[model samples]
Target: MRDLPVLTGDAVADAATDWPIAEHRVLGRGRLNTFVSDTVVTPDGATMVRDYLTHTGAVGVIALDEQERVVVVRQYRHPVGFKLIEPPAGLLDADGESWLTAAQRELAEEARLRADDWRTLVDYMTSPGCLQESIRVFLARGLADAPRPEGFVLEGEEADMEVCLVPLDDLVAAVFAGRVQNPTLVVGVLAAHAALRSGREADLRAPDAPWDARGAKAARDQELGELEAP
Candidate 1:
């Protein structure tokens, strides 16, 4: 049997630790801001500067059709300079939105899809080494084609986006073959495939579940800002 996590208050505190930020500075600002320097001090007097991006987190949806196929969108990422296929995902920090609401909006906007059933599939950090971004994947079934939100226009690369419906088995093959490598897409597809293969629904977290790290990190950053105020 797998070891269960400790759910005590102290254990929870330890699990959601907010590292002491000795100093913090913003290097640049944009839609997603950058924290160019953050001095972290440990209890043992060790200190280090961590340069990482600050994100509001995001959500991805794996919309499944009645035929057991999943929808994917193709768009170009300028930073990577490669066209990538991924599930419909949107930022959580947008306008102080909830995770479920963001996922639902992204589903409609990206894939022109609506679903009757939804469940949490997996939650992941895209790049832990240098990014503070986390994305929660949701499995959405009972899908039907729908019109995009009124007066909401797709812009830039999204304006030319392409959508495709691929069988879950084939998608798993592509994921294993590295043909479809978007983290959210790969994780969501493989997880949904595994769950369906086992003929059982995976135990899922509540859609509005609280994410400790996102808020805890922000609070830590806020405390540092307060200390720096003069």
Candidate 2:
């Protein structure tokens, strides 16, 4: 048998690459997201038009209390027609706000809570094939109750959202049983579980860890927008 290469932790990194864009156009613009189409040239000399949504990115917080309970919110997702159990999360719509600030703000606004300890749990691209939405999930401990953000009022689906705490072990089981399908919650639960089991929670990335993919995505979006402009 051929000798296999030794496994190294460094081999799993994701690299950034882009194809040449021949054309770009906005198909539609909604309140929070934009639908666009791009004509990209493949390396094999074929050109294809791809339609996708341009998002503002987002952050989610897995707030764990002293008893290993995770604070979560049940909110209705109109497009999916299901009320998903998700961690406190929100978009990066506020200009110039850092991702950690966004995560902290969301935890308060959506769950009426705050945390003194914070670490990055994971960062992922949601539907990278068609959507440009990047999400950062944070593990927040040292929990305490806090008032909602000033001038923040829940509306529509958020108005009916319910906040509750569930044991982390239960959440992990739900994830494996296919009971919870929200991407953020699934990834956050599994990552947090592994971190705790491996005793590496403290060694996770800092709350303000550098996120180059998000910055690169924003820059590419700007260039595409400029190209689509008259």
Candidate 3:
């Protein structure tokens, strides 16, 4: 693995010190929505940058089954003014729970699948240039059926999601065809693919076919190892 670049405390402090907020305003706030505008003096001091953004908490999953099919959702997106095909996802609404907990809830709500295997893939800014929300993507496996929660319904909202299963290669091809454009979906799918490949390699390296009582545990361990590290 390539070593990541280190950032010193002094460097971060210098950068923070250079940022001066001259003015700020609360643009608006509605159900699960908050908007704000801020004026910041740039490092060069030639111009002031005014930033406006909306903030929300988001969660998504790359759900895979023993058959290797990935669960996806088809929903209408108003922002893009079109229908979008993507993974099971939703906004975080529960208080006091960690982000991963919210991800598990969404996975159960959207796809009705509870994954015995869970791993956080990445935390990323969805649109740093305009939005203040950060999205957490997770990989889920060893799925079992669950009853859909009552409060987790998204019907009558601006979205109507239909759950579907897609083969891995077909989904990747759709991504390249511009059919799957959601950012979180792309990242989560790729991460799951890499994890699956790693699990296969580990199995090949094992000395024996761990098919007895030890076999199931060995297989689960391989999956967990690939998950936790990424």
Candidate 4:
């Protein structure tokens, strides 16, 4: 085999591409998400129908306290049938809410904590193949106890959620040992670990950083009139 090409600086990044949708329709609508089918025309002129969920996106918070412990919550996920250990997270379904505001709200609601310092840890698509769910995870420090958001009554799984602080190192270990499988937690833990270890925590993105993926999705949603269609 020839010598592997040496990769250099930050040329590797996700770019958005819009595929031509010949037809689109809503297959179903859930309480918080929409199931849609799209007939896409490929560049080669072949058409394929794909079904996926159009989500309202979400935000996660990795609340790291002074002792380097990370706030986590164990909540039951019905679809996966597991009480997953995850960073506090919630959907961005509220009208006119910013992602940073949503993250702060979820942290307060799920963990009953707030942070004076917030930075973007990472952003990811839960499952791009079949879900348009994008999650922005924030690294939160300078923690303090806070009351739950008013009228945010916990029900079902939320009512049973258990919140605790786990050491960042322990969470990282659990992630590698396959003990924790929640994607947001795993990514946030690892990202926080990497940043702290490399002393690059200060270089992390601002809490209000621009999210191109979300903007692109919103534009596409508008173009398709997905939210307005009855």
RMSD of each: 4.0, 1.8, 13.1, 1.8
Q: Which of 1 and 2 is ahead in lDDT?
A: 2
Cα lDDT tens digits, model 3, 1-230, are 99998888667531112355565556776676546566677878855655555554577888888788889888788878877778888776666666677777787777787888676665566776666566777777788998887665566532467888988778778777877888888877766666576774233222111213223323533543453353
| Tens digit per residue, CA lDDT, model 1, 87-134 | 888887667677888898899999888888888887778786677787
Residue 127, candidate 4: C-alpha displacement in angstroms: 0.7
lDDT of 4 by residue, 21-89 (tens): 888888998987789889999999999999999888899999999899999999999999999999999
Against the hidden true structure, what lDDT does model 1 obtain? 0.82
Assess candidate 4 and give its TM-score to the true structure.
0.94
Candidate number with greatest TM-score: 2
- Clashing residue pairs in candidate 3 are 210-215
Task: Give me the overall lDDT of model 4.
Answer: 0.91
Say which prediction, candidate 2 or candidate 4, comes out ahead on lDDT: 2
- Candidate 1: deviation at residue 45, Å? 1.2
For model 1, give the 10-residue run with minimal summed lDDT: 9-18
Instruction: Tell me the whole-model lDDT of each prediction, alpha carbons only.
Output: 0.82, 0.93, 0.67, 0.91
State the TM-score for model 3: 0.73
Worst 10 residues of 3 by lDDT: 204-213
Of models 1 and 4, which has the larger lDDT?
Answer: 4
How close to the true structure is residue 94 of candidate 3, measured as C-alpha lDDT? Answer: 64
Candidates ranked, most accurate by TM-score first:
2, 4, 1, 3
What TM-score against the true fold does each predicted structure earn?
0.87, 0.95, 0.73, 0.94
